[model samples]
Target: MTDSARPRRATLSDVAAAAGVSQATVSKALNGRDDVAAETREIVLAAVAELGYRPTTAPAASSRRTIAVTFDIPASPYILNVLQGVLVAATENRLDLLTRLPPDRAARGQRAVGRDWIAEQRASGAIGVVGLTLSHPDALLDAASEASLPFVMVDPVDATHKRLVSVASSNWAGARTAADYLIGLGHRRIAWIGGPEASDAARDRLYGYRAALDAAGLEIDPAHVVADQFDAAAGARHARAMLGMDLPPTAIMAADDEIAVGVLAAARELGVSVPRDLSVIGFDDTPQAPWTTPPLTTVHQHLDEMGRMAVHTVVAIADGRRPVSRHVELATSLTIRETTAPPPA
Candidate 1:
């Protein structure tokens, strides 16, 4: 191999390093492995193209069978439950899964950079996508569409998004059910701990709780409705303020289990007894609910079911089939537990 006859060529290692994936993953992306995610595959292919990398052996296949799952964060039981279900479904379907997060934004309301990503997915032969929270979903949808890939949204912010497929629990009905359950237990004054006021799901739940009160001919005390970020700390913060009121609510209905857990902690700190002095209800029967000091009464939002459904939808699209519905909503059921009881006399 003389210097005149030899030229430097990019190898799999170079592509892998550039794409921030392993060599094996790059190989899987190019060779049509059923285990490579679409986004990762796209990244590999783009690197391959950019670096002018050529395979020493057989070239990549024409078709790629992979599903990509994206999320805002991998923490929290609600997200974990959904992810576990997706993993199970992927195994059952014999499909590869890839998970990624949106590029970090300097601030809110600014879209994440994604035009090149969609192009890469197309070139890399990605078949489908399950989006949890893409900072710039509109761009992704367009890119995915252009690449002939199907995109499914789990717990979308807006169910009425015309161009997207979304799967979620019935938030409105679930909130209403929780409130009604508290009322059934002879609790007249109930407080609601809600997520961000800007969230549609949170708004729906707040309204549902209010609707339940309205139907029962009970006035919803505006002061009782405190906003939280659907976390334990936020729940605690809001609960303290409410619990310190001139006349506190006999029961509290939380928008989510995390918030409810925080509320429970607040109750404990303030020496409020569960079910005896105060009844509590939460939404999203996450794993935390069962382990609380007194098991929390909550609305079961079917996180696992939603995850399974999301996988099924994306897979169907990959197989050249269309989903029966663009918007799929699973039913919510009330789980009666130790935290709720008839109001104290």
Candidate 2:
């Protein structure tokens, strides 16, 4: 065959044929769809690599793409990380991104602004919606399902209703990691400062803290578990209450970095020395964790990965790919810093 006549490019169809799969299967495997079996998907990927096939980047295809992302709060560092991953991936694919913030940041609530936003975007030909920490209304979830808007949630919803497509870090595991760290350091008189009553994360964190105590053959002190909102001020309030108790705890676990900082401040005000008179461990290792006075020992939530997964799931669904489940949970790790230590003698 003449060099000019030899095919210079392998197409998706060629890869599918080589892997003995459908064209759609090849697309799913290449696009990181979670629907395909791991082994079969790996085979398809290997075939793609062997065939040196690349997806087309024609303007016609590029112009057909747009995504709307709604976040629970624009001010949250965690949400900011999620947004970064979604925006970076979308930009790389030459997709248009429309970011929406909740109507009232002060209300500290998530409004399904996504539904109305989705309607307008759909009028302009948007393909899907990606939401981070989305506390969507039931009607909005129903609307997404009816409209087939390819909705992807960043994490699990507090209440159960179907139609939630999500990719999330394991809050339970993150909390467990924090508890394990405290246990390993010989902190037996531990307490937990949780978030609001309605938060899925707050519940998971509380469970983990209790699990660790149970494993150590310790009874959970009801008075030691203080649940509050997910803010520094709330943390301070809870910490103050805990500190004021006649028999205060030796260590406290906060559900987030902000709460941990509040605890630290409260400890100082009450003349309690961290890691000496008291120990504080937290979750979400926010950027502020290391900056805290004694630094903070906390759980490392993979927010960037969560964001990427949410975007990938939404975009894949938009392209007619079905994921394995409506819910996806990612893993989390622990970051041990200087804040926690053995209880005082």
For candidate 2, the TM-score is 0.77
- Model 1 lDDT tens row, 1-345: 898799677888999999998998888887667688887877776787566565554335533255678777678788899998888888888766777665454432222235455544544444567876334366666555544567888877533335788888899999998898888888999999898776667888998999999999998889998876868999889888988999899999998899999989999999999989999899989988999989999999889888889999988976678899988989999998999999889
- Report the lDDT tens digits of candidate 2 across residue range 9-50: 888789889999998887666554678888877677566545
TM-score, candidate 1, is: 0.80
User: Candidate 2 deviates by what RMSD?
Assistant: 13.2
Candidate 1 regions exceeding 4 Å error are: 1-64, 107-112, 120-125, 133-136, 158-161
lDDT of 1: 0.79
Worst 10 residues of 2 by lDDT: 106-115
After the best TM-score superposition of candidate 2, give how far the Cα of residue 47 lies from its true spot, in angstroms: 45
